[model samples]
Target: MSNKNPSTTRIVELAKQKSFNTEKKVLDTIKSMIKNKKVINYNTVAKESTVSKSFLYKNTSIRKKIDMIRNEQADLKNVTNHKGNTSDKSKDVIIESLKFKIERLEKEKQELKDALAAKYNDFYNNL
Candidate 1:
């Protein structure tokens, strides 16, 4: 009477049943397949588990975990780059400060020489 294909609908129902098991069996199977290099792609995982790709996409916790891992990797790269820049800047600042101090010390040395020469005429006369 209705538009239902009973056999086709029954297969679909069985596949859907495999998609939502409360036991750890489904996740464990997925992990084992990954470990054995059997399920290679998301499509394969979906097919093997009889789950839809849309189901994986809709799981907010799994999506958030993936995002967090990516964010942490990016943060690590940024910190490494920042450290390199800071190290270079610190070296430049140290070199500039040393150069300034050297110039100041040379100026003081010249001034002291001039003052001594002026204060002692006999020193110059004896020489």
Candidate 2:
């Protein structure tokens, strides 16, 4: 009941092939980005791979993989932050100790100068 010509059939076939190729290319790009430890968020991947954000969200497998990577990165960041806090605390303690030492040294230096001045005055008077 339809006049489907050979050229139209061939065009449809080529279009389908092109779409398949594009999808495959996008998936391949995503895998490569993951392997390279690149940021695997939806926006980043979509931008880098030239894939539509809607396609990424609609594909359940890709969406899940991206989510997994995102979660792993978040966990790593949290651990690093916790360790940094401990290091900061130690650094604070070291800074405080250095400040106390500087204050003690300044006080000692003032006392020595006063003693030296008194000794010089005594020598001048005895002369």
Candidate 3:
């Protein structure tokens, strides 16, 4: 007969059940995250899934999955960064357009001022 106490066996069984449930929960959480196209990283997964970072890092399978997904995302991130740089070019274009507008407005103001002065001179001469 096994020498283990009954209570000890019961406690061990409970611990095993809890561990299995936790593993399942973490796996399901990851699958759903992938489905939803959410960002997957150690910090994000830990925070979103309400699990400890150590737990995710410690589990061999989960660790591998996280590493693979993170690696794939790094490539996508580079592409996004490249697109975002166009904002700087757009800013330059906007600035040039505004400068052109200001120059045109200033010319119009000067013409109006000259016309006003000519009208005043004519009025005084006629008086």
Candidate 4:
């Protein structure tokens, strides 16, 4: 016979079953939301399922499924080219951002060089 009391074992089993049922319920809620094209975020899932938001975030598998769906949905909104690549607008945006960054960096570099030249002139005069 096991060391644990029968009642305690029964209680533990019931708790485990409850947890499993709740997980299933949450998953079903997510599926229904997907079928209905509803948002699949933590708050929406929890609200639709009547479960706790913490519970939705706390469960690893459920969290991953939600994240995967949400990310896939977000990607659907992007403008893609024929080969499922970035659109011209997206490329243009990326190019503009890089150009801005390069210009800013070049300005900073010039400022540094000017400061260094002034410092060198002072050092030479002092020597």
lDDT of all the models against the reference? Answer: 0.63, 0.84, 0.88, 0.89
lDDT value, residue 102 of candidate 1: 100
Q: Candidate 4: how large is its RMSD?
A: 8.7
Across 1-127, the per-residue lDDT of candidate 2 in tens digits comes to 8757535778899988976786777778878997888877889988988988998888787788888988998888788764434677798898899999999999999999999999999999999
Query: What TM-score do all the candidates reach, one by one?
Result: 0.30, 0.50, 0.58, 0.56
Write out the backbone clash pairs for model 4: none
> Top TM-score: which candidate number?
3
Off by over 4 Å in 2: 1-19, 82-127
- Reference-based TM-score, model 4: 0.56
| True-structure RMSD, every candidate | 19.5, 17.5, 16.8, 8.7
Where does candidate 4 stray beyond 4 Å?
1-7, 80-127
Highest lDDT model number:
4
Better of 1 and 2 by lDDT: 2
6-106, model 4: which lDDT tens digit per residue?
Answer: 46778899999988999999999988998998868898998899999898888899999999998988787564423558899998888999999999999
Q: 63 in model 2: Cα distance from truth in Å?
A: 1.3
**Per-residue alpha-carbon lDDT of candidate 3 for residues 5-124, written as tens digits (9 for 90 to 100):** 555778899998987788788888888998998989989888877889998998898899999998888888887764445687798987899999999999999999999999999999
Model 1 local distance difference test score: 0.63
Candidate 3 wrong stretches, greater than 4 Å:
1-6, 84-127
